[model samples]
Target: MMPAEQAGAAALLRHLAGAEPIETHVSAVFVGPDTAFKLKKAVALGFLDFSTLAARERFLRRELEINQPAAPALYRDVVPVTRAPDGRLALGGEREVVDWVLRMAPVPPEDFLDAVAARGGLDGSVLDAIADAAFALHAALPPVPGLDAPAELGRVLAGNRQAALAAGLPPARVAALAAAAEATLARLAPLLAARAAAGRVRRCHGDLHLGNLCLLEGRVTPFDALEFDEALATIDTGYDLAFLLMDLDHRVGRAAANRVLNRYVARSGDAGLTAALPVWLSMRALIRAHVLSRAKGPGSGLPYLARAEAMLAPPPPRLVAVGGLQGTGKSRLARGLAPGIGAAPGALVLRSDEIRKRQAGCAPEQRLPAAAYTPEASMAVFRELTDLAAEALHGGHAVIADAAFLRPEERAAIEAARGGAPFTGFWLEAPPEVLRARVAARRGDASDADVAVLAAAAARDPGPITWQRVDAATDPLPAVRNALGLNPDDPC
Candidate 1:
């Protein structure tokens, strides 16, 4: 082992042998059999360094100060490592101080989200709790200005490109990768500026994978925030969340990722932050690839590079609408179809009901008065719907607009907005009696329309709608599959 490794091992042994300890992949943790102490390795990386004793002490203090708010139960204090008169290492001894380490309270490994995920048991409740905790952390963290946000991300992408090149990647492949990174940065510059102005940039847990979160005594806790540099940790809040989002995506849990993101947005009420998610997720995946490229371990950079490429792959822009009367399951089918439609995870779902409510300046669950449902208001809603769909599709997203296209003009507007891209319209239909019964049984819904409204909508002429009709009584998945031209058995 090199000197740093030897010192790390010695520090681990000193801490572990002094108490009943838990061994992890990187750190040998001592649990006081109750208190936990983490010692930094005397190593230097481009972004962080613990090269000197003083540097280590400084960062150790910072770790405690920064993490205490988020993980108050875990970050106990920062303590000095001193040498005894007999030249033995001891924590906070009376002799001259040799080093310092972060002291925390050891929590059970089963409390960690990774452990839960490993056990094949991550539920909405756990995900919601995690999202809430992360939102609180982001809200509490102080902002750091003048960070090299884009340049740092570009460096990561450039490093990945160089690694792919060093491994004999094709020139065209490398060029394409560079171009994608540059284009993404250019596109996101305005959004980044807006986010910074909104105070969304903050010093956060630079590394917020599932492994960094735990359930301590039935409460969620986050630990081990980046303490070396404010610039590394101080980033857009979307970037902070993207770490976990990308991790979930890598695990093939895109649905879970969506659930987490939606829950975070709902809790934080920061829907505008989503405009930056694609850039942040791309950056996070690139950083992961860069780190893996430097690893000498079993699973190296090859798989991560492939994942990065997949993450950075540009999706074909298309607008598909799931249109039907109320209670015809448009939203349900749209939700089911979105992940598999070749768009990034959490692709935009623009529901006409939500858009209509927004146009009326009310909440989704609030009822629109009679005047708010006038023909003029309806036209305005349709116009806004088409506008949003066009914008999202133009921005390289596959969109599913859930609405009741009862009017010929409304349907025509959507078709016209497709703008030369292949547009598939899914029309869900149910028997009149069945539709009436379904609408009557619905509860806690936003739509003011009842069976009478459904009857009116059904009688209206849906003229020249280029759509595939799906039977609402049967499994909508088959029709959805056929509409998207995918195998029904393939798991999205």
Candidate 2:
């Protein structure tokens, strides 16, 4: 070994010999042997404290307790340091206790996802393993109480907005951003409440990035979870997954992010999460922006801030109205097109079915009573949908409005919201028989329409539209790609 490496080994030995291990280590962490010990810093942050030895011991115990479930084999135990009669430091089994350190069997740094990605050795299988492991972990977490859900979510959102404003962001832009966040939360409040009632809010890893994950023995393992703040770690599962999504977005991995989301959702059977993803993703972006903004100046977060700004920068907004009768795959096409147009984390998809269901106090598959679909209710849904799309677009997001916009006035409302922005009007069309078959095949959906409804929509005159027809016979993603004038082979 070189002089520095030899010096590092000596320092490690000295620290190991001490009764109370020192927190500071001058040596490189990864260069050391397979086994590593970590000591808590004797400092106190607002959400965490290790100022006292007892506090550090408490947190160490908590870390072991929390991590053992997900990574039982890796987390060895929290062992106390003790002094010998001869005034020599030793680990455990001594007469008198001095301090405590969390002991663990360390894995190689090469096992990390970032390291693999850097070496161009990452593959879809690795990503799949990660998604599967994360999904399983999420499923195992205990749900938080319903009453605390809204307040906790509100605090997170408000804190981010306040931080941006405090960081010297333009007042108008800050207010606009705050309004956008508030509006999205308000729109999804009911859905969030329902999910909370269904126990979707759970104790989770608050910071889930590739760097926190590793491939151990061909299985993905996540470590270094948020051990300090239960309030931060306990959140809606979507929020937990959003961190990874935001991380992928920052790395310019849009397709991979979507694939992870799709795969996780499929495995977990959490379709309701789809409706909640945009809200969580937006919150994640804003949180990252806030963290970055705070990192400005010497010995601060400048480097991280620059990266966050790039990730949080708003995308050019486009309004794409999906016009078709029920079961023509409007929603599918809109989802497919969203990631392709807007910035990876900035795309805003506004779905009429989801909005209507939220307005009607029911799940998507629940049939809307005749009273719920009154002219006034329908008008309210349309107004809300357009309002959301316009707000999202103005906030630098691509908006896809999915609805059966059979009436010219409905189409006009959407067009007026575009406000000279580049727009695409996708008119998904299928034969009457195909539409009926598609609607019938759907097990659970918000649309109450049937064959008659499709027949009536087809009979109605669709006024002049600058729209492209999507053949239902083929995959809608390819048709959307072609309509957007993008390469069909584009991985997005």
- Whose TM-score is greatest here? 1
Candidate 2: where are CA atoms >4 Å away? 1-31, 161-176, 290-338, 341-480, 485-491
What would the per-residue lDDT of candidate 1 be over residues 178-265, giving only the tens digit for each residue? 6876788778777667677677788779899888888887887888787787656777888889898888767637766765665565
Per-candidate TM equals 0.74, 0.62
In terms of lDDT, the poorest run of 10 residues in model 1 is: 1-10
TM-score of 1: 0.74
RMSD of each: 5.3, 9.8
Using lDDT, give the best candidate's number. 1
- Across 74-137, the per-residue lDDT of candidate 2 in tens digits comes to 7788777666788665667856766666777667778888787677665656766777788889
Over 4 Å off in model 1, which ranges? Answer: 1-27, 83-95, 128-136, 139-149, 159-176, 187-200, 217-220, 262-282, 297-299, 323-327, 351-391, 403-422, 431-468, 487-491
